[model samples]
Target: MNDTSRNVSFTDPWIYCLDHGYVTPMICQSTEVLCFLLGTPALVWCLWISLSGSISGGLKPTQIFPMNLCIVELLFCIEGLFQTIYYLFLPNNNMFLQVVYCLFFIAWVCRPLFQTCICVERYMAVVQPVAFIKYRLRRYRMGTSTLIWGLAIIYPCFTVSSLGYLTKTNDVLVSVYCLGGVVISFCCFFILRALKQPGPGEVEGGRGGEKKQRTTDPQKMRAFSIVLTNLVIILVSSILVAVGFFTMPNSGIDFYCNTFLMLLACNMLSVVVSPVLHLHREGRLHCRKGPVTN
Candidate 1:
């Protein structure tokens, strides 16, 4: 009888509503406002640095890739700023909210896609020098970047357009929740492949008189480090969200808090951490030289 009563309570819509009532609409508004206030200036700074082009020097390809990643981050951050303001100020307008949510999803998902491409570029630079040099021309790089952006946009747009129709069903919601699982698995697979491969300097000894060494290439290590770091962020946040949604019937408090934290962590990855990682890796943080010279 007690177990039956507990199940009944858990399944009741009123009970769910009561449990989550502490997360008022006003609090959501305030949180969005605060996130926007902190994100805008950072976005502008990243853009300014990217446009200055002062960092374009030796290893232009390598330097420009980070700048490209920074540009993507800046764009996403600006989008996030708009999203936060929209959600905070006009929470009840469903049409506008829907548009903002769409934009938010696009920007949110694209950040990692762009970062993945950057990783692949770095891997190519270190692992396939001859091919990398051959394709290092401005036209080729620009074309490649365009292709990546197009694919990223197209993939999600198609999925959203088709799958969104089914979101009204409970089963569809569960399937939609599994989307992050697919992304996480794919990213981890590629990152592991990149890590296992030998880097550029690994095969060749330093010099005739120098000792043969097995040290990891700094660039490759940095590439691996960045990918692994972001992967951990994405994976942990996704898991938290999944657990929250899946276990919501059992514990509404845990579900709400974990979901909120997951959303915030994912937003931080898209808006803050991505650019910071690029800036730090490129040595642009302290240098007044505009951007980091690749």
Candidate 2:
């Protein structure tokens, strides 16, 4: 009877949530496996092709954030892969697994920050071209990237083995995620507005400059697509975080499962979308006449 009751409780959503404070391992691991299968190959392909061009020539300002995002997705994929494998064998919680799970939080934290960086970069490029050109040094992006990476890695590392610290960290992250979504949305709006307005050169020189800007319309449209896509991704993620934070406490294990599954869904979306966007921009899937210039 005890064993039977234990088994019932193990599979029971509310009971399991109360006991474990996490989603059921079997369900979470199965979802992780699914995400791994779907995301890895595409991410690897995108990263390789992107690196090929950027490495042989030099890294363009536009390429930097996407590459960093690619790396973060790869790390997230690999971590999920590792967890799936680990759970396949053990199927039980342990201190080691908890530590490994911290990687998930680290990736989660990094994703929004990196995405915000990408949005801001795109915004400056399209909306404030003069300023973008002024501070377009690789070092500036490199410094920002370095700082983000350090903080993402360090914050989770120090919060190790402490659920309180982890919870606090997540609370802070949720706020940041909300802010990121707002920033991305505004960036998208401004980029769209920029698309309609004439550039300074166009205003000064009239129709000829207008014609030139029209010729670059395709490039502007592509930039807007990038920002819009990012806004959607960030918005979805923010909703998930808000849902998880609000519901995970009083909810059942199924809610936890769905919440995490949606988060991974966003990850998969990013993996697929980033590569598609990169390919489009490289003209690998399309033809282009001249490089994008404002």
Candidate 3:
């Protein structure tokens, strides 16, 4: 018995209190693989389109937000890739674990911020076009982008001070998600109002026994739809996070692993879905049938 016990201990030295020690890493690896598969092609295509458009001077100031979003998704994919590879190869390496966590943490926080920034840019364009003109300067957008990236980088520094608890980081995420929901909702209200109002050339002359008609701008309605979509996405993502946080305590190992896995799934989903929506907005995605048969 002593000989058998010694052999078992030698082969598997890592001690774990959980019933299933490998469950969490298995979940992480699976989800990370899915994220990489789904996110890479879409994100790469988006980056290419955005960069090509910029080179040709066809990119708008508003479009930069989606470009920023593409960058976030790329970071997210890279984090997942690193995590998957590290766990598969060096699961016992604490140093690599910390590096993966830091990358994951930064990408996790930045996703919502960039999503909100995109909605804000669209809000200004749809709600206050006149004011947006001045704010649309290249420097303004660049400055705001720089500020957001800076904050994301600096926010993780608090983890060291917090002894790795991440309490404050969680608080920041909740606050940002809530604020993003509010901003997107506000944009929805204004967009709906604009959609109902008639534009300058929408009213036709009624003097020649013609009926007066009111027409809405296709552009405004499109913006309204986009804002509504963003609101739904933000609300759903926020709810997922809230549920995870609220139910975290007194949970079983499986529950904890599942919760974190769900959160990662949610993050990857939003990353993939947001870019597809933006691609549609940018006129990159389309459906067309082949030529009609004789």
**Top of the candidates by lDDT:** 3
Which of the numbered candidates is closest to the native, going by highest TM-score? 3
Model 2 regions lying over 4 Å from their true place: 1-31, 198-216, 250-254, 257-268, 280-294
Tens-digit per-residue lDDT, 1-294, candidate 1:
332224212113323433556453334344445445655566566656656665463335555555665666555555656655564476466566445545555555455455555555655565566977887777766676677577645654554445432132223323443565565556565766767676666755667845466667666666676667777665564455455445544444443443543455454544555555556666666753333445
Give the per-residue Cα lDDT of candidate 1 at 13. Answer: 30
The stretch of ten residues in a row with the least summed lDDT in candidate 2 is 3-12
Full-model lDDT for every candidate:
0.53, 0.66, 0.68
Model 3, range 49-157, lDDT digits (tens) per residue?
7788788987677777778878888999889899777756887876776677678667877777777777677778767989888799877878888998888877665
Model 2 whole-model lDDT (C-alpha atoms): 0.66
Over 1-294, each residue of candidate 2 has an lDDT whose tens digit, in order, gives 332222121123423443555444455555567657766776777888878888899788778887888888777777777766655565465665665656777777777778888888878987899999999999899899999899888877777656566457657666777787788878878887887675544344446543332334565566666666656766876677655654454544455554644554554455456655555555555454333433
**Could you tell me the TM-score of candidate 2?**
0.75
Candidate number with the higher lDDT (1 or 2): 2
Q: Go through the candidates in order and give the clash count of each.
A: 0, 0, 0
